[model samples]
Target: MLDKLPVVGRFLGGRVADDAGWRRMEALLRKCERRPVYRAWIGDVVVCDATLARRALLDSDNCLAREPSVWQFGDKQRVPAATVTELNRWLHGAAARHDVDAAARIAVVALAAASGDLHRAALLAALDSVADMLGFDCNPELAAAVRVYIGDVFHAKLVNAPLDDAQIARAQGLASRVAALLTTCDADLPAVLRNDGVLTGAARGEVYLHAVLSVVGASAVMLAWLACVLHMDTVAGVDTSADSRAQVFTCKPEHVALELLRLWPPASAHGRRVLKDHQVGPVKALRDDDLVIPVFVLHRHRDTWPDACAFAPQRWHEDPRPAAFMPFSAGPGACIGSQFEIRWLAAVVRQAATLGSLQLVQVGRSPCANTMFSPPRCRLETP
Candidate 1:
């Protein structure tokens, strides 16, 4: 079983805790993709071929692959026979539910970012209360479990505390109350709230937590990256007020997040089992075989992104990248929290750019990538 697997297995189970491991994984994929054997696999299953990856991402019928068992049964089913059908259904339903929560989370984060301290506290508490009603822990058990699984799968050392039910419950209650208050005021809502798909009854607390973590964590990383960019740009000793004009650009945190997605995406790869025999590129995929799509490689394809590895927010300034940039993925299996993540990240960046000076300092090793999603590590000293 995944839980019983060694450290590497646990890490692969998606509980990544640090940036070093993530970088290592990125390096490994880069190296592997260059080899012919690996390229064959990439072309056949991993979506390294730009055309194939895009097609698979956009065409629902061709891309409709079964969900991985880990998501449905957790680490417990790693040793046993698990039904792909059940896993697929669970994943689809979960993704839909997550999308709705994502919007709400983004709204709360944005409101907090724009408001005064008192308003921020009230909004945060309301958000916590809603989370409690939905059973989401701010610090979730799934995150920990995913971490342990990733550690075991990747042979990486685990580096997070076990899930704390009491703390999570308390945090949820506090957040929901704040969220409710924020939503009660029409002036505080984002434009997305008026859309049909923006909110759903499926907005449970667990999904809300996931949405919050996704946005907050991504924002934290982009903020670090932004500081690095600012420092590099100012190396010639130009007087750059970290606050004024920068705030204008900062308000669109989604833009910063889009850049981060292009740089170091949260998910490196995702797997789907072929429901029926299919051919991708020159390789034939058998039914029940897993097709591993490497988002890292696909995102960095030179054909899709010029200077693929370079950090350039200007790309988003031009146009949204094609479906090939599957940071949140595409099609039916796409990440539900994608929109919320964009909103939350934008809010965080805007806040930092407007209200405070953000200095990125190395705090400790980044969390080990024990989960499928890896968040960077850095300390932001605000002055």
Candidate 2:
């Protein structure tokens, strides 16, 4: 029934991680939240409210585990389970805590190197720096391969399309080279990775392979700071030029960051598969194989956040809803690196403020919707 309306179906089904699509998704989520669980004809079941999103995420009954297709790239291959959990522990727990400050410093250096309209290069470099802490950024060749393969696949997945045969083959070949590089590279790495006995020898190789290869997705978090800068300027009704930097920020950088993270998180959705028949809040999702919680829609819920879609930093001080917020998600599966990403976000904003001003090159445009930002191409200048 819903699919008949081309506009409505596309609006509901589209991944609105990009800036332009966020508002549309936000409105749809608001419209749909009248029911505890909403069904969309465009794709899968969606939960946009905070209460339901939280329950679905922290599902203790094990009714929900990660959707199988998430780790897939252009080829739709299954990432080994051992590889996923190990990288999660190493990247989220070990690397995030140890390297957040380094990520912050890298962000500063990468930002300073930009001369014209911004590109993904700086953000990629900063993300690569985070990878370095994990020993993935060492091989120049492997790093280059990761950039192409990871970026190509992540962008394509949003449209529900896989890359072409040639693209897939290139990614596969590069994946092999990268796997070899990571496992064999002599660079000193984290102790967890060094703990050879934690993994079987073959699984150990795959662990490092995924660690280095996946860095592209891992690093895309910094782009949220771009959205943060643009969002603040739009809300404050000020220009982001050298003379107006003072007017652009109404409060502390952290406060601005918190609000933007609420509205425009780097990662926008979490998906889980139902093991069997189960109920989550208002929705009986057990019938559906896939249950999706959209953080983009979840954060701005009207019931959860009054004045939900509006940019109001002051709300943080007044609201008791912080626990309801899910920028890093909720439950046992929540992102370990969230604090690390937070540091990168806060530091980016503060640094931009100190640098004088920033203005997106596409003045009237929004970024393309994807997992990471199209990392807005912008120009930052000094007064």
Root-mean-square deviation of every model: 10.7, 5.8
The best candidate by TM-score is: 2
Which regions of candidate 1 deviate over 4 angstroms? 1-20, 28-44, 62-253, 354-360, 363-367, 373-376, 379-383
Tens digit of per-residue lDDT, candidate 1, span 1-383: 01110124343322343444555555645654563123232333445665576566555676455332232211222211232333233334443444333434543344334322221222332334233222234335433332222222122222333335664444445434333433333331232222223332222222323333433333333333444444333211122344422533643556666766665555566556577776776667667665656676677766667776655555677676676677766665566446655654554455443333334444434433444333323334433
Runs in model 2 with CA error above 4 Å? 1-27, 67-85, 96-99, 115-119, 150-162, 188-221, 224-250, 318-323, 354-359, 373-383
Candidate maximizing lDDT? 2
TM-score of 1: 0.54
TM-score of each: 0.54, 0.74
Q: lDDT of all predictions, in order shown?
A: 0.43, 0.53
